[model samples]
Target: MARIRTIKPEYPVSEDLASVSLPAERTFVCLLTQADDEGRQRDNAAVLNGALWSLRPEHTALDTEDELRQLAETGLICRYTGCDGRQYLHVTKWHEHQKISHPTASRLPACPVHEPAGWCGKCKAKGKGCARPAPENFRSLPEALATPAEAISAQRPCTAATDLTPAVDVSAAEAAAPGKAAG
Candidate 1:
């Protein structure tokens, strides 16, 4: 009978701690920083939503609609309820791209027919129109029509031609005569 040889498997043993190079450590740090930045952005958005909810609970649903859509597109906010209630705003499922940024640098200019042209109604009535347009331009139709003539006329030119013409300063009159304008 021939003699058979047996071979033993060898395993390596380590004694010193594994050393990670400075560059590798740096790479890890950079990854952590990016993760932290993303987290902070999410937190900021939550705070903004909370503030809006506090200010106008009724409009809370609409306040974050645009933001929510953006999140969905970017895979942030995965699912959201649409205004219709039947359709769901799914970021990943959307066929078309939706704009995630602010609609404009600022809110759209108020409708000239409804909003005051220059300043507050009190100022308009006193013939001292506001230095700036009213901040609250959104108002009901009844309210817009009910504004005081003095407030409306304050900013209006003395010429009768422009009297009936709709001007941007209409909000001033509406603010002054809430009963008539807001009715």
Candidate 2:
């Protein structure tokens, strides 16, 4: 079943995301909610249409298939046949945007083209590396979806979230207390 997914506010302005047609953009956004915790799903257009565009009778499975091709071509998503010979797709930057607290393991096989050899959805082998490391080609965080700290630092020097003090008059607050002096 599909799981909840995050859509950072920066999505609409992303150069790579904006490169696609509006329909394809909508498809991409909708696909976010439809994806598994690992950002994977079956690559059947008909199934996707039934799940994603069911309310909109105007859209068809063929349209979804075309959008999928557009997403793949733009490197937003990866499509491949698993070892079981079933087709699957995964968002290329799943980890960059999502911060699932307790992600469930994916039942689908990993894409061989993107994953290390003998990868079994787990980073088990010594020195094999992360099972789903972010792609090297990803743009810097400022231009892409960034974590809260990255976003803050991109605009200014990094500071802990707690360092931000609330705007209030301390003397007035102290005066309001029954036993405190205004000074």
Candidate 3:
């Protein structure tokens, strides 16, 4: 009987070994393939393990000292300066005094809370405060008009259901009924 032999498939080579002897073009291809495989593996692992996976690749094997220095000089990629004078990666400063110019001769300081308020209709109609108005000149008419009317009304409805008697008719009712008390 003839002797039977079996050959096992070789596992994919690590990136370090592939980069060492490959030509520049081949090395790039190998590096890209390795990165893709690593990413897929990491994603699979994350799914299987039920945990957060780092999206940013570990660059230790690919990066040289020069590459690291270059990245460092470019500053933090996601940092922003907050109004509280702190360097934050997520929260940003809101400039409440930012000005918006109208098509006419006006500019208004943007309110951080309400934001733009559609070019201040009253200011546009009045042809004033179109742009960068002085604090003294920044009187907002719409804000004044927005007050609750019920709060400022001079007359309020009587809450007592039994006190339906009109103020002028109370004396007339007492005189007609004789024994009825006037309240």
Q: In terms of TM-score, which candidate is stronger, 2 or 3?
A: 2
- lDDT per residue for candidate 1 within 28-120, as digits (tens), equals 222222221111112133343454344655544333544443343344223321112212211121122233232222112211222224222
TM-score of 1: 0.16
Off by over 4 Å in 1: 1-52, 55-62, 79-85, 89-183
Query: How large an RMSD does model 2 have?
Result: 20.1
Candidate 3 off by > 4 Å: 1-134, 144-162, 168-183
Q: Write one digit per residue (lDDT tens) for candidate 3, span 40-86.
A: 11112222112221243442223322221222233211122222222
Please give each candidate's TM-score: 0.16, 0.63, 0.14
- 53 Cα displacement, candidate 2 (Å): 0.4
In order of TM-score, best first, we have 2, 1, 3
Report the error of model 2 at residue 95, Å.
Answer: 0.7
lDDT to native, each model: 0.29, 0.74, 0.26
Better lDDT candidate (1, 2): 2
lDDT of 2 by residue, 46-137 (tens): 89888889999999988888888788889999887555556678888888899999988776656555654534543344224333432443
Candidate 2 Cα lDDT to native: 0.74
Better of 1 and 3 by lDDT: 1
Q: What is the lDDT of residue 72 in candidate 1?
A: 34
Q: Pick the candidate with the highest lDDT.
A: 2
Number of backbone collisions per candidate, in order?
A: 16, 0, 5
